[model samples]
Structure formats: C-alpha cells, structure tokens
Target chain A: GAGVSQTPSNKVTEKGKYVELRCDPISGHTALYWYRQSLGQGPEFLIYFQGTGAADDSGLPNDRFFAVRPEGSVSTLKIQRTERGDSAVYLCASSASGTGGMSGGYTFGSGTRLTVV
Target chain B: DQQVKQNSPSLSVQEGRISILNCDYTNSMFDYFLWYKKYPAEGPTFLISISSIKDKNEDGRFTVFLNKSAKHLSLHIVPSQPGDSAVYFCAASALRGGSNYKLTFGKGTLLTVNP
Candidate 1:
C-alpha cells in the first residue's frame, strides 16, 4: 500500500456490540502500532507488534480491547462488548524496523471513527 | 497521569508572524520527542523530531526544541502561514531498541493562523 490503510472509515454500533477495525500497513514495514484517540485528547498508545508477536501490550485499556497482527502485515483491532465511552478514532501506524533506526517517522492511516451508541 | 502535556488548548497567530507551541512532559525517561500536525479529519503527520543527543532540530519551517533538563519542548514556526494552521501534538518516547518504543502524546494545541 502507498500508505497505511484502515477500513470502515466510520463505524456505528449499539453499546455492547462487538466491532472490529482493520489496518493494512505499508509493504515491508515490520512495526505496527495501534492508538485510540478520544474527543479532545491526543492519541493514546494501545498496543504494538513486532512481527506476529505483540512486543508490548501494556497500553491496552482493558480486557475489552484487543489487537492482533497474525501475518505481521495486516492487523485487526477488536473491541468486545463496546460501551458508549468507546466512541473515538482508532489510528494505526507502521514503520520499517530491524536495525532499530527507521526514524523515517511513522506512516499513519486516516483512522477509523467508531461510535458506540 | 499524562506523561506528555500541551497546556494551551488553542492558539491564534497572524499569518507571516511567529507561532510558538509549547509542550511539557513529566517523564524523564523520554529521550525522543516528535511533533505532529493534523488537519481536521486527518491523522497526524510527522513534522519534526529531536533526539536526546540534540537540543534542537530543524526541517524547513518546522523546528523542535528539546530541553531535557526542564523536560519541556516547543515547536516554533517562523513566519507562520495560513496553510500551517492545524492541530499540533507533541509526542515522546524512550526509543529503546525501537520495538519497545511506544509514543506517548499530548492533548494537542490547535493553532489557527489568520491572514
């Protein structure tokens, strides 16, 4: 992909409904990151993936939120039993890693706006 | 607790003047800092960055200054232009080995440049 791509740019679901947001990172990028941005707040880190394994999951808000990067390429962020408070934009970013110096800066997707009513 | 903080919620600057956006962080472990610009409805775009080793970095009209001692940083836009008007966020991370690095961002400062 020319840039990081996220699906279902806008999603609306009733509270308690499960929703899944998808992200397709740039080709050959090895590091993928997920972030959640609420109204009037900066993007908060949720999880990060290095290859198929999650290197750090400390930022996940709670058990209700989870993400996976099975092939280390396309990833999905799943929210179970969503609440109205979960309404916000989910952002995904990718960067080339491995010598640890991909400082080219992260390429981010437009983001998915999820509204939990 | 917010590791990164942008005190000003909004800023209005006259076009062609200087616009200085400030940010502060409580985490001393954050050695890498970055500034991102976002337009309405668009994800943040990386503007400039400064590593722990350097006190300042410049990229065209964007410059990021890092003061490790104060745990503060600021983005300065000289001769600010209307096109430069947008929401600016400050992010910080340790950048440890890359994979362990996770960016912590501030609430962001909205800069409205008026002509």
Candidate 2:
C-alpha cells in the first residue's frame, strides 16, 4: 500500500461494548504505531510495534486498551468495555524503521473516529 | 503534566506574510522535534523536523527553529498562503536506545492564512 490504511473510518458504539480498529500499514514498513486524540488535543501515543513484537506498550491507557500486530503488516486496536470517555479518534502510523534516524518521518492514516454513546 | 505545550490556540496571518507557530516543552531529554499539519477529518501530515544538534532547519517554505536552552521551538511559514490554513501540531521524541521512538505532542495551534 502507498499509505497506512485504517478501517471503520467512523464508529458509534454503546457504553460497555467492545470495539476494534484495524490498520494496514504500508508494504515493507517495519514500525507500526497507534495513537488516540481527543477533541482539542494532540494525538497521544498508545502503543508501538517493531515487526510482530510490541516494542513498547507503556503508553496504553489501561487494561481495556490493547493492540496487536500479528503478522507485522496489519494491526488491530481493541477496546474492551468501552466508556464514554473513550470517544475520540484512533490513529495508526507506520515508519520505514523503528529508529528516529528515518528521515522521511512516519506516515499516518486518516484514523477511525470512535464515538462511545 | 503536559510535557509539550502550544499556548496559542489559534493564529491568523495575511497572505504573503510570515506566519509563526510556537511550542514549548519541559522535557530536556527530547532530541528530535517535528511539526505536522492537519485538516478536519484527516490525519496530520508531517511538515518539517529538526534535530537537537541543530538550532534551525529549513525546507522550501517551512522552517523550524529550536532553542534548547528555553526548551522552545517554532515553525515559520514564509509568504503564508490560504492553502496553508490548518491545525499545526508540535511533537518531540527522546530517541532512546531500544525504544520505539514514541512521540509526545502538544495541544496544537490552528493557523488561518487569509488571502
């Protein structure tokens, strides 16, 4: 793919329901990342993956927020028992490498807007 | 605590004039800084970046200035155009070894360039 792709561009889920957001990164991208942005705030880092392994999950808000990059090409963000406070945009980004030395910068997908009602 | 801060919520500038967006950070460990532009319903696009080793970086119409002592950075757009109107976000990364290079971002400043 020429860019990162995120599924369910918009999602409206009821409180306590589970929602899953998917991201298909660019071909051959070795690093994948997930971020969440609330209204009037910048994107907040959630998790990061290097290959099929999660190199950093320290940013995950809590146990309800989880993400996985099983095949290293596509990733999924799962929110269990979603709350109203969880309503926001979930973004996915990919970079050529996990190192900051990659000059080009990370490519981000449009993102999935989740509305927890 | 907001490690990164964009105090100004909005900025307006006339076409052909320089538009400056400001940002400040509290974390001195951050070694890389980046700027991104975003439109409604769209994801942010990378604009420019500067390494801590350098005080200034320029690319075409965009320039980023970093002041390590003050933990401040600013993005300047030369001859601002209406098309440049968008929300601009400032991000910083520590670039720690074996880390995933996570970025900390500011609240963002909305730049409105009028023609």
Candidate 3:
C-alpha cells in the first residue's frame, strides 16, 4: 500500500460490546503503532509493535485495550466491554524501521472513529 | 500531569502571512520533536521535525524552532495558505531502552488561515 489504511471509518457500538479496529500499514514498514485521541486532546499512545512482536505495551490503558500485529504488515486493535468514554478516534501509524523515529516520521492512516453509544 | 502542553486552543492568521504555533514540555528526556497537521475526519500527517541537537530546522515554508533550556518549541509557516488551515499538534519522544518510538503529544492548536 502507498499509505497506511484503516478500515470501518466509523463505528457505533453499544456499551459493553466488543469492537475491533483494523490497521493496514504501508508495505514493508517494520514498525507499527496505535494511538487514541479524545476531544480537545492529542493522540495518546496505546501500543507499539516491532515486526511481529510487541516491543511496548506500556501505553495500553488496561487489559480491555489490546492490539496485535500477527504478520507485521497488518494490525488490529481490540477493545472489550467498551464504555461511553471510549468514544473517540483510534489512529494507526507505521514507519520503515523500528528506529524510524530518528530517520523520519511515521505515515498515519485516516483512523477509525469509534463511537460507543 | 501533561508532559506536553499547547496553551493556545486556536490561532487565526491571514493568507500570505506567517502563522506561529507554540508548544511547551516539562520532560527533559525528550530529545526528538515533531509537528503534525490534521484535517477533520482524517488522521494526522507529519509536517516537520527537529532533533534536540539542532535548535532550528527549515523545510520549504515550514520551520521548527526548539529551545531546550525552556523546553519549548514552535512551528512557523510563512506565506500561510487557507489550505494550511488545520489542527497542528506538537509531539516529543525520548530514547528509552534504545527505542524511542513512543510519542507524547500536546493538546494541539487549531490554526485557521483565512483568506
């Protein structure tokens, strides 16, 4: 893919329901990341993946918020027992290398607007 | 406590003029800084970045200035265009355990470039 792609641009789920947001990173990007943004706030780090392994999961709010990059190319963010406060945009980004921070910036997907009603 | 802060909620500038957005951080470990622009219903796009080693970096109409002493950074856009109107966010990262991929971001400043 020329750019990062996220599916289900918008999602409206009921409280306590489980939802999954998918992120398809640019081809060959070795690093992937997920962030969440609330109204009036910047994107908050959720998790990060270096290849097929999760290098950092410290940012995940709780066990309810989980993400996986099985093949290192595509990733999924799973939210369990969603709450009203979970309504916001979930963003996915990827970089050429795990150390892409020093080289350049990550290319981001449009994101999935998850609305928990 | 918020490590990064963008005090100004919004900024308005005329096209062809200069637009300046400011950001401040309390964390001293931040060694890399970046700026991103985002439109409604879209994800943020990388704009420019500056390393802690450099005080200033310029690319085309965009310039980033970092003041390590004050823990402050600013983005300047010259000859601003209406198309440049969008929310701008300031982000920072610190090298921890040899990997610095995690980014800490500010609240963001909405810049409206009016014609």
The prediction achieving the highest DockQ against the true structure is: 3
Global lDDT of each model?
Answer: 0.88, 0.91, 0.92
Q: Give DockQ for candidates 1 onward, in order.
A: 0.53, 0.62, 0.72
lDDT tens readout by residue for model 2, A1-117: 988899999999999999999999999999999999999999999888999999889999999998988888899999999999999999999988886323556889999999999
For model 3, how does the per-residue alpha-carbon lDDT over A1-117 read when each residue is reduced to its tens digit?
999999999999999999999999999999999999998899998888999999999889889998988887899999999999999899999998876555478888999999999
After superposition, the stretches of candidate 3 with alpha carbons farther than 4 Å from their true spots are B96-99
Question: Candidate 2 chain B TM?
Answer: 0.96
In the range A3-93, model 1's lDDT, one tens digit per residue, is: 9999989999999999999999999999888989999999998888889988888889899999999988999999999999999999999
Interface RMSD (Å), each candidate?
A: 2.8, 2.0, 1.3
Indicate whether candidate 2 or candidate 3 has the larger lDDT: 3
Sort by lDDT, best first: what order? Answer: 3, 2, 1
The residue-by-residue lDDT of candidate 1 on B6-109, one tens digit each, is 99999999999999999999987777888889998888988888888999898888888888889889999998999998999998877664533578899999
Decide which is better by DockQ, 1 or 3.
Answer: 3
TM-score on alpha carbons, each prediction: 0.95, 0.97, 0.97
Which structure is stronger by TM-score: 1 or 2? 2
Displacement of the residue B40 alpha carbon in candidate 2, Å:
1.1
lDDT (Cα, tens digit) per residue for candidate 3, span B29-61: 889999999999889998999999999999999
